[model samples]
Structure formats: C-alpha cells, structure tokens
Target: MSQMQQITAQGRQIEQDSFAIIDHEIERDHGGHSFSPEQWAVVRRAIHTSGDFEFAKLFHFSDGAVERGIEAIRNGAKIISDVNMIVTGLAPRRMQPFGVEAHCLISDPEVIAEATEQGSTRAKVAMQYAARLGWLDGGIIAIGNAPTALYEAMSLCQQGKINPALIIGLPVGFVKADESKRDLMATQLPYIACDGRKGGSPLVVAALHALMVEAAK
Candidate 1:
C-alpha cells in the first residue's frame, strides 16, 4: 500500500503536515552544567519509586526497545515493550531511573532466546524484582494476556488504575506491530508513537506533546 492510501484510511487530521513531531521545552540553561539540579531531581524521583511509577506504558517491536525504554523512564514515563531481551539488556540502564516499571508481551521463542540471558543470575534477579513489585508481570497473554493492550485502554480508564496523564510509548519497527498501535490509537488514549524509519524517541515525544497540547485547549 502506498503512503497516500494509508493516510486516507486513517483519516488523519493533518494540521502541520508533520506526521513525526518532537516537542521539549528547550532548556534555556543549556550547555553541560545547565539544569544540573533539576536533572538530579528527576533522577531522584525515579529512584525513590520502587521501580513502579504509577505510569501506564506501551512498547512493541524492535529489539533495540530497551534503549528507547531507558529514555522513556528518564522522561518520567512507564513502558510496555515487546516480549524480548530488550528489557533485560536494559536492566542496568533502567535501574538508575528507579521506579520505572516495564511489561512485555511475547510471541516467538526464537526471538525470546535471541533477546535474553535465559537463566542468568542478573536477569533472574531483575525478573524477581519486577514481579514482586508489579513492575514486570507481563509475559504472554493471548486474548487473556493484556488484550486491552491495544483495542482498549480500559485498564487505565475504567478503573482509573493509573494517573489520567499516563502516556504510551510504541517504538515498534515491525509490520504487524503497526496493527497493535493502531488499536491503541483507536481508544484515543494520550500517547506517543512515532514512525520507525523516520523516527526514534522523537516519535513518542511528539505524541506526548500532542496530548499535552491538545488537553490544554
């Protein structure tokens, strides 16, 4: 399908003709030392939490998801990544952010094996910590496994389980992964999902900005 066709079907509201947008209040205190105190505060807050930040999240596709996840936590967001070793590989990185919780969905064993340290002590420890704290309970859930993941975000909405300001991070670079994200958008939840080839963390950030900006109106 052509890009034009996809756009037409989605009925997108193109106000800026900018599908991929990134918005961050440019720090006036730039350079290396700028916002040193503020940055520390962010890090400290993340650390204070027990790896479970009341923030709902969403992540799919790409094995490099861990890198994006680290970025998400730094920005005070939770994560839901595709089932793989990305989270484990990023365990050390995420540990610093402190209370950043992560949930993952699995489908392929070959991919899983290629992703994690299957039985390694550190990996096991991370898993244990996540489970005990409700930070990593997501494994594989067919329809029974977090189905609300895509079609509906009722988990966050109906029960008010998370902060209404919760955001989603979908960095999927896979084909089928697009469907899941589309399902997510169907719910109109506040989220950030960027295009794969034409984006990176910027995509998620753009979506975040859209929600924040739209809400104020």
Candidate 2:
C-alpha cells in the first residue's frame, strides 16, 4: 500500500479511537443528563472537537432544536457564518451531498464598507446584508466568533425581519459573548448555544456537522 494511503487509514483510526474514548468517558461521567440521542450526538461532537467534557454542561438546546437543525440540514439549508473559520472548518464532503451551502460575508467588500461607514462591526453588517438578501429565512445562522453577529441576528429575528430554521449562537470572547448567548436563550427562536463564553468556531462546526451526520441517517 502507498504511504499516503497508510497515513489516511491511520488518521481515520485515530479519529475512531478518539470518539470511542469520548463516548466511554461521557457515559461514565455525565450519564445523568436528559439529552436525547440526537442532542447527545451534537454534545459528543463538541467534546471531541474541544477536548473539553465541560461542553456537556455548557451546551443548551431549545425545545426540538436538534430535530429542527437536522431537518434544516436535510432540506439543504443555507448556513450563514459570522467568520471565515467556520466556513473553512465545515467539510464540503459532508455538506455537498446534502446541498448545504455555507457562507461567511464578514470579509465582503460591501460588508466592510458598510461597517466602516456605520462604525459597527463587519460581522453585524454582514448579517444585515444577509437579511436584506433574504438568506436568513429558513437558513441556519451559525455565529461562533462574534457577539455582535449574534446580537444582530437576535435583533432581526425579534423584528420579524428573518425567520431562520435554527440559530447556533456560540460566539467566544470576554466581551458580550456570554450576554448574547443568554439573550438568545431568553428568546423563543429555535437555537443551540453554549451557556457561557466558552465557545468558538470549532464548536459551531462540530454542532452543524453532527446535525448533518444525523440527517444522513
């Protein structure tokens, strides 16, 4: 066998072993939680990605959030992200078969220009642009690195401007990250979020990929 093929096999084996370990540890340590199987898939993926079992405690899922998120993925929902890291992290092989499209407009020229003119964040302006283009309706908005983006998404949802199928609000920082996630939980929107500031792009990617994986089944 080719060396490259051997390395690929080894990588897959490592991933499988890691997941096995995560499952065993989570079962041993946090078996009392009430998450359904699908929700547990997402939480397990988060733990696998971050190596932080604390994610089992930090994750918050709204009523039917996992079902709605999986439904949206199966329906080929567009995914709007606050930053490019999430866009890059989402595996195309996992998304393309389901016709899912992930976008990050934070670096768009128009978004940058508007944000500069308004003295606001590029993430916030990008969300406004997405709303104007009607992409938020029935889409999955994943905000993993910017509190401003999460705040704007919540504002738009509250104003009835956009009705996303699911919002993954997991921005990380010392600023308004915790407050934004709390505000999202207070809303009636369909959502999955981290309860505190301990979230990032990888968590969002893990959550979405988990949903995609479940949808395929």
Q: List TM-scores for all candidates, in order.
A: 0.31, 0.95
Candidate 2 versus truth, CA RMSD in Å, comes to 1.5
Which lDDT tens digits does candidate 2 get at residues 143-203?
9999999999999999999999999999999999999999999999999998877999999
Worst 10 residues of 2 by lDDT: 26-35
Q: What is the number of residue pairs that collide in model 1?
A: 3
Candidate 2, residue 144: the lDDT equals 93
Off by over 4 Å in 2: 1-9
- What is the per-residue lDDT of model 1 for residues 93-212, given as tens digits with 9 covering 90 to 100? 323434544444344343345336553223223323323445322221111112223333324344443322333434344543455455544554443332222222333332333322
Cα shift from native, residue 128, model 2 (Å): 0.4
User: Against the unseen true structure, what C-alpha lDDT does each candidate score?
Assistant: 0.33, 0.93
Q: Pick the candidate with the highest TM-score.
A: 2
